[model samples]
Target: MTAPTQERYRILALDDQRETVLSLQRALRPRGFDTEPYTDAARALDALASQPDSYDAALFDVVLPDVSGIDVLRRAKRIAPDLPVVMLTGDERAKTAVQALHAGAFGYLTKSTDDVDSIAHTLAQAARQRLLQRRAAQLERSLERVYGFEHMIGQSAAMRRVFDAVTKVAESDFGVLVRGESGTGKELVARAIHERSARASGPFVALNCAALPEALVDSELFGHERGAFTGAVGAREGAFERANGGTLFLDEIGDIPPAVQLRLLRVLQEREVVRVGGGAPRPVDVRVIAATHVDLERAVSDGRFRQDLYYRLNVVHIDLPPLRDRLDDVPLLVAHFVAKHADRSGHSPPTFSPAAIEALCSYDWPGNVRELENVVQRLLALVPGDEIRPEHLPSRVVGASSGRLRAVVVPEPQPVVDDLAWTDGMPFAEARRLVQERFERAYVTRLLDQVDGNIAEAARRAGMDRSNFRRVMIRAGVTADKPRRA
Candidate 1:
C-alpha cells in the first residue's frame, strides 16, 4: 500500500527576541512543519528574496534592530506576493496592527497571553492559505506547460469566463463535467482541477471507456478478484479503488456498457465498489469526474443508454469552447507551442511572420488545439529558417486560407451499423450494428477531441440535455477518459 501524503509547511520566523523565535519554532515544529528561526531580520529578508518559493509563510516580530518587521514584510511581498506574512508585536495599539496589515502583513498578533493560541492558529491558517496559492500557481505553470492558460486559453471574454470557472471550481470537491469539442483540452481542465483541489497530492487516475473492449471495461474500472476471469492472475484494485481519496476521471463515459453503467451508478450512490469476484464491497472515497463525447440524451431517447446515472454525475458542468470559437487565442497558443517544442528540440525558437500568423488564424481548426500543436511541430521540423512564413505551414492550412478548402458543418448523425462493409463480409446485421456503434463512438470521440475531451460539451453537441447525456454515456459503454497506458 502507498503511504499517506503529508502536507508540509515551511515557515521563516524572524524576531529580535531569540527566546520568542525559539518558542514559536518549537510550537510550530510539532505540527509537521519545518521552521527556520532567525534573530536577525536582515538575514531573513535576504534569504526570502533569494528563494521566495522555499517558504510557505514568514512570521516577524514588530521591531528589530537591523530592520523593522514591516520592512521585512514589504520585501517578502515583493519577492512572493502570495506568501503569507504575519507580524508579532508586544504593542497593544490597534493602529500599529492596522499599519502592519496595511503594509501587507496577512495578520498582526501581539505577543500576549491570549495571543499564543491565536498566533498558532493564525499561523496554521496562513500556512493553509499559502499552500492553496502555491497550488494555484503550480497549476498555472502546468497548464502553460501542457496547452497554455493552464489548459483553458483565451483572451476573449467568453474564454476568460471559462478560466474563471476553472479557478472557482479548483478549490472545491464538486465533480466537474467539462463540455467542449475535440482538441479543446478537456483533460487539461481535469488536471488543473485535480491540481487545485484538496486531492492534488493524490493520484489522478483516468480511463476512456470507449477505447477499451467491452469485456475488459468492468475489470479495468473495478478490479477483478483473482480467478474471477480468465485473465485474472491476482487480486487488484480498480480505478475507483486506486483513486480513493483522489479523483477518478472517466473520459468518454458515454461509451460504458449497460451492465457497467449499473455498477458505476451503484458505486457513485453508495461510495463503494465490489470487485468482480469479491463478495464484499470496499469503501472508496473517490471524487467521480466523468466526461463524454456522445449525445447521451439522444442515446437515451434511442434506447441505447441509461437515464438514471445522468443526474448523478452532472453536479458541476464546465463548458469548454472549441478552438474555432476562440480564434483570438491562436496567436498565443502558437507562440506557446512553438516555444515548447523548441525547448525540447534544443533549437533556437522560431518566430512567426505576420503572414504565418494570419494563415493560422484564418484556417478552420477541425482538430482544435491538438491539431494546432501537431501543425506547430510539423512546421518546426520542416522549416529551417528562423522565421516561419506562410510557406512553412502545412499546404492544407495555406490552401484553406486561399478558399481551396471550404469549411463544412457535418450534422451530428447516429452511427450507421452497416457502414463497415468494405473490409469484411461479416453478416449485414452484425456489420450494421457495429457500424452504428462505431458511428456513435466516433461521433462521441470526435466531440471529445473537438472539446479536447471535455464530456459535457460533447453531450450538448450530440443534443443530449445536460442531465440525460451523462446517463446515456454511462450505458453506451462510454468512459470519461482513455485509460492510462501501462
Candidate 2:
C-alpha cells in the first residue's frame, strides 16, 4: 500500500470475472486486507485517480473487459507513481510476464489462491516500502534535509549500554520498560526500538500517561464509545487498538492510577481490549514499551505501583544515564543541537568555543538533554557572533564549571521574585517567558516536595484541579517525589 490509513491494508483489484474479485476479497480479508474490486477497468482507473491514497497496492488481471491489463497498469502508474501493482493472468507466455514487469507491475500472479497467498506474504512489506519512498521524496522536495541520528546522539560507555540493550530488546516482541529522568530521551529510545523491530513497518503510537487527567486516562488508553462521556460524540479506537500490529509507547507509566494499571494488565494478558463506554473486545497485536521518570522499585514497595503489572511491563529494563553522568557526549550533542536549531530558523549555526563547551559539560543538567538543547537554542538566539565563548554560556553553566551551583533551568541563581538574571541580548518577551516558566517549575516542584510527592494533595494546595495541575507538572517535567497510590 502506498499509504496505509491505519491498521488494515487496502488493495484495488481489477478482474472482469466478478467471482474472481469476490474470491480475492474473501481470501485476502483474513490476512488483514481490504479489497475494492472493479470489473470495469475505466471505473477502477477513475477510483484510483480520485482516491489515490486509499489503496496500498493494486491487482489487475492481464485481460480486462474494455482495456488490456498492461494499458491499465501504465495508467495506474501514471496516477500513483509509487503504487505497487501486481498483474494477474493464467498466461504462461514469457513475453507478457516480462512486459508487465517492465511496465512497472509489482509481480505477475496466476488467478489461483496459491499465487494470491504468495503475494499476500509481501503485501505489507511492499506497502511500507512504497510509503517510505514517497515520504523521502516529499522531504527532499520540501526541507532539503536528510535525517541524522534518528533522534539519539550518544557514544559514552553508559549510553553504549543503553544502545546495546535497545538492540537486544528490538529483536523480540517482549514488553520493555525504560527508566530515565525526564528529557533523557526515553521516547527516542522507544522509537528506536520500534523502528528497529519487526513491527517497524507498522504504526508507533505514544501516549503520555501523566499529561492527561485522571478522569480520561482510562478512556484514552481503552478508547470510548459514542455517548461514553460528556465530550464523546463518536466511537474511537484506544491506544491499544490504534497500535495494532505495532508498538505502543506509554510514557510516565508510573503515574497511571492503580485501577487503570490493572485494566492495562488485563489488556496485555488477554491480547484485546474493550472500549470504555461500549465495544466488543477487539484483538490487538501491539508490543508495549513503557517508560517512567520515577523510581518504580520504591513505588512498588510503597504500594504506589502494582507489583504484578510492574513485572509484566518490566520484561526488559533499560536505564538511560542522565546528561551529567555522560559528559563525554556533550560536545557531540552540542554540535548536533546547534545544527538542528540553526536549521530550524535558517541561521548559519556557529561553533562553541572550547571553554564554552567545557562549561556546558561541567553543568549538572537536571533536565537532561532536553535542558541542554534549550540552553543551546537560547545561546544561538542571544549570541550574535560566529563563535560562542564561555561568557555566552548561561551563568549556571559557568558557575557550575567554577564549583558554584545555581538554579538549574533559568539564568537566575535562585527562584526569587526580587532577583532576576537576564541572558545577554535576550528580548523582553523572551526574558518574561523564561522567568514565568522558571517560576512555574519551581512552584510545582516545591509544592510536590512539600506534600511529600502526594500529587492529589499538591493539586489541592495549588487551588487547581488535579487535571490542570498535572498538566503543569508534566510541562515542567516534575513528577511526584513519591508515586501516588490508589
Best by lDDT: 2
lDDT (Cα, 0-100) at 266 in candidate 1: 92
- Over 4 Å off, model 2: 1-149, 403-486
Q: What is the TM-score of each candidate against the true structure?
A: 0.53, 0.54
How well is each residue in 445-486 modelled by candidate 1, as lDDT tens digits? 566657654566777788888667655543333334322343
Alpha-carbon shift of residue 338 in model 2 (angstroms): 1.1
* Residue pairs of candidate 2 with colliding backbone atoms: 1-56, 1-127, 2-56
| Per-residue accuracy of model 2 over 142-238 as CA lDDT, tens digit each | 2212122346776667877887888889999999999999999999999999999999999999999999999999898999999999989999888
- Which 10 consecutive residues of model 1 have the lowest summed lDDT? 404-413
Each candidate: how many clashes?
Answer: 44, 3
